[model samples]
Structure formats: C-alpha cells, structure tokens
Target: MVPRNRSVRRTKAALQSALVDLLLEQKNLQSVTVQAICDRANISRSTFYLHFENKDEVLSSYLLQMIGRVHDALRAWTGSDDTRWTVYFAHIAHIAPILGSLSLDGGPHAILSRYERQFAVIMQDLVMPGRVPTNDTAVGYAAHYLSGGLLALTWWWVEEDRCGTPAQEMSRRYHALCSGQLCP
Candidate 1:
C-alpha cells in the first residue's frame, strides 16, 4: 500500500532519491544495499525497513513510477494515431536512465511482467479492441506475444543502444516502421 501522510511520503521520496543517486554512481543495481541506502538518506535502517522490504522493492517501486508516467502519456494521447510510436519512444527515452538501471537480471521478472501486462492491456484497449480474436486463448496469446515483443524491443533499445542513432532519429524510424500498422 502507498504510504499515507506528508512525513511518510517525504521519507519514501528520500529513499527513492537516495536509491537513484546510488544507482547513478554504481552503474549497476545489484551493488545497492539497504543499509547503504538508509545511511545515504540519513534515515535509520528501521525507517527504510518501514517503507520497503528490500532493494528489489525499491527498484520495482521506482520503475513503476516511470512506467506509470509513460502509461499516462499513452492513455492521454490526442495526436494523430500515426504519431503513437513517436509518442511512446519519446516517453520511454525520457525515462530510460532510471528505469533501465532497474532492468538487471537480479531484478524480479514478475515485477517487469506485471508492468508489461498493464501496458499490454492498455494496448489491447487502444489498438486491438473488438479486433481481438474471438477465442479467449488466442487473445491472451496475442497480448502476451505482443507485450513480450514490445518489452524486448524497449529493453534492447535502452540497454543495447541497438539503433546507434539519436533518440529523435530512432523515434522517426520507429514511426516509419509502424506506419503500415498504424494506418491499416
């Protein structure tokens, strides 16, 4: 459950901020330790424990906030449907540094899966809808497949620098690649 009250919220924010700063310096997630985080934030280890169970919880919580912002942008889309990929790429790129750090193998795939499922449901609502296959099995498989592809592409884009191009250029190419699907 989300913390209630101003002090709890501030403590949570401080923990999150300290976590991010540590990540920036470490260049990896597994190196982070709860005691270190508590020390960095000037909070008691008990205080950190009060807010998060472990480092994984901290990373998941941080990534979810980034994912939530992108999801909100996707839901609020009002531009040409053709611009959807551009919007998505821009949103993901904007949040890449923080979120990407949390994508290490040490992190739980279940957390990533949960967020991807949410994104898939949103995509189904926006992009598939009545067009979803009549068979529930088929629709489930389709959503799962599509969500995995998106997750893989996004992961590769942020982690591998696969495009070897600027984000704006990659966004352009992404839109171009999906033009056929976006239109019809």
Candidate 2:
C-alpha cells in the first residue's frame, strides 16, 4: 500500500471549499475560472494542477465525495433483501441536504441518467452479492425504466412547491410495485 500524504490532502480540501464558496455566489459554474479558484484557495497554479486536472475535475471530485458517503451508507445495509429498498431510501433521506444542494452543469435529465446507472449497479450488487447479472439488454431496460420513474418523482419533488402529495403518491406507487402490484 502507498503511504498517505496529509499536506496534499489539505490543499485539495482547501481548493474544494473555495470552489463551493465561489459557486454559491456565482450561481453558474461556467462563470468561475481556474485562476479564480487558485486565487481564492491561496494555492499556486502548479499546486492546483497537481491535485486536479481542471474545474470539472475539482467539482466532480467534490460531488463524488458526497456520493461516496451515500455509497458507504448503502453498503452498510448488508442485510436481508426485504430491507434493501428501505435502507436505500433511508440513506437518500440522510443525504438529502447535499443532494438537493448540488447544482450541476447538465440538465436534470442528464444528471438522472447518471444517477440511475450508478444506482442500478449498486442495486444489482445488493440484490445479487457476488453474481452481478451480465444480461446487457435486461439491465439496460431495467435501468432505463427505473431511472425514468425515479427521476420523474425526484424532479417533481425538487421543482414543485408541493411535496406531501407527490411523496405520498410515490410511496404508494413504490410499495405497490415492490409488492407485485402495478398501478396506473
């Protein structure tokens, strides 16, 4: 195993924090530049380049950290199949603050596609242990359908002012689907 470097880690964190603070005021990621980030973080250009390739990499790294936390929470639920979905959603709830706060460049559709693919991998692992299904067509179909449904629900929850009805409806629909019952 390689040795850990504390100073490098601290510089990376400084850059990330600066980026987040800048985004909060800038509102659009495109408005920020690498020089601005380096300036705010009080690091040399070479230092920034050493840690990250560019702005996108820096932002992606920050987002991935948040995703990693959720991933850990998901992995921790290594229990019965009955509680898999429950634990998954519970983890989502735990990370709702960070997830909701994320403002990415791509539109919601693009983001959800990535989200679904990632979750599909996680779901397959949780459902099948060492044997992840390799049936491409089936996996694609399931990922598309499930991602679309989840994305639609997530969109409404994020965009619409009303939350109670949409959440209740989703809960009912999800329960019905999981219980071998389909809803129109």
Candidate 3:
C-alpha cells in the first residue's frame, strides 16, 4: 500500500511538472493537449486519463495545491508582526513561473472570475478568524474587494519588467496599504 501511494504521488508530480513545462514553453494553455502532456511526462494515455480528466483539470489541481501551501503558511504565521507580508511575497516569488503563465492571455482574469467567490470565502476566513462578521454581506464584499486588489497587485508585480523590487519591499508596500499608510 505504501509503495502504491508513492507511485501515485510520483505519477501525479510527473504530470504536474510536465504541464508546467509545457505551459512555460507555449505560454498558452489552450494549445496544450492531453497527448502532448502525456508525451512530455512519458506516461501512457491510459495512465493520464486514469489520473486527470483533461489539461484544465490538471492546471486547476496544481493551482489548488499551490493555494493550499499558501494557506498552510498563513496559518502557521505567529504574532501580529507585519513580516507576514514578507512570507506571502516570498511565496509568490517562489511560484513566478506559475504566476507568469497564468497572467498571460487573460488567464488571470478568467481565473479570478471563476474562483472569485471561493477565494472570497477563503480570504474572509483568513482575515477574520474565530468570530463571524456581524453582516455577512458586508464581510463578503470586503473579502471580494481585498482579494481583487491583491490579485491585481500581484499580476502587476509579476508582469512589470522595470520593477526589480525585492520581495521585502513589496511586502512593506503591501503592509502599508493594509494599514492605510499607502493609498491604493
């Protein structure tokens, strides 16, 4: 059972890695095919189908996995120290390729539109832990606003060519914005 679980993990990792490689090379997800993914991953067609329904499913799974990591990091953060932004920015920097690929060809826009509600719920939980907001609608709106602003800022940071800003500076700017010290 242990070996089987390891094999399953290895196969999924191979598939995910292949998809990322293809995404980087092509810069477009629409052009990527299951056969191409299978070829890149050196997995048979039957095996690919056994694991993922399609390329989009693979991409979605990868995004969810990445988000889970961010959530875990956020949960582990201790104290009210503003350095949490640094950790967040560093995670974003670490996943530059995924961000770059998603920012291209209106991919970010599509992703935000599709996942807006889900992201809002997650952000709200993160920002307001334990106690529920008195007004659910108001909290939902705030979550949407914050999530949209953060996504836009992230896309800008990732896409900017002249912006050689380090993660620490970005983190400081983010903290400033949250504190109303920097206007959006």
Using lDDT as the measure, the top candidate is 3
lDDT for position 112 in model 1 = 68
Task: Show where candidate 3 strays beyond 4 Å.
Answer: 1-5, 133-135
**lDDT for every model?**
0.70, 0.63, 0.75
Give a tens-digit lDDT track for model 2, residues 1-184.
2235778778888999888777776765777889999999999999999999998678777766765665676578665544444543554454343334453444445555566766666545444445535566666566556555655655555445234343335555654665578887
Q: After superposition, how far is residue 102 of candidate 2 from its true place, in Å?
A: 6.8
Compared with the true structure, the alpha-carbon lDDT of candidate 3 equals 0.75
Cand. 2 Cα-lDDT:
0.63
Q: Is candidate 1 or candidate 3 better by TM-score?
A: 3
Return whichever of 2 and 3 wins on TM-score. 3
lDDT of 3 by residue, 35-93 (tens): 99999999999999998998878887787777778777767878454566566677778
What is the descending TM-score order? 3, 1, 2
For model 1 the TM-score comes to 0.76
My TM-score estimates for the predictions, one after another, are 0.76, 0.64, 0.83
lDDT of 1 by residue, 84-180 (tens): 5566677667666655666664443455676877766766765677885645777766667666766766777877755344555555554554443
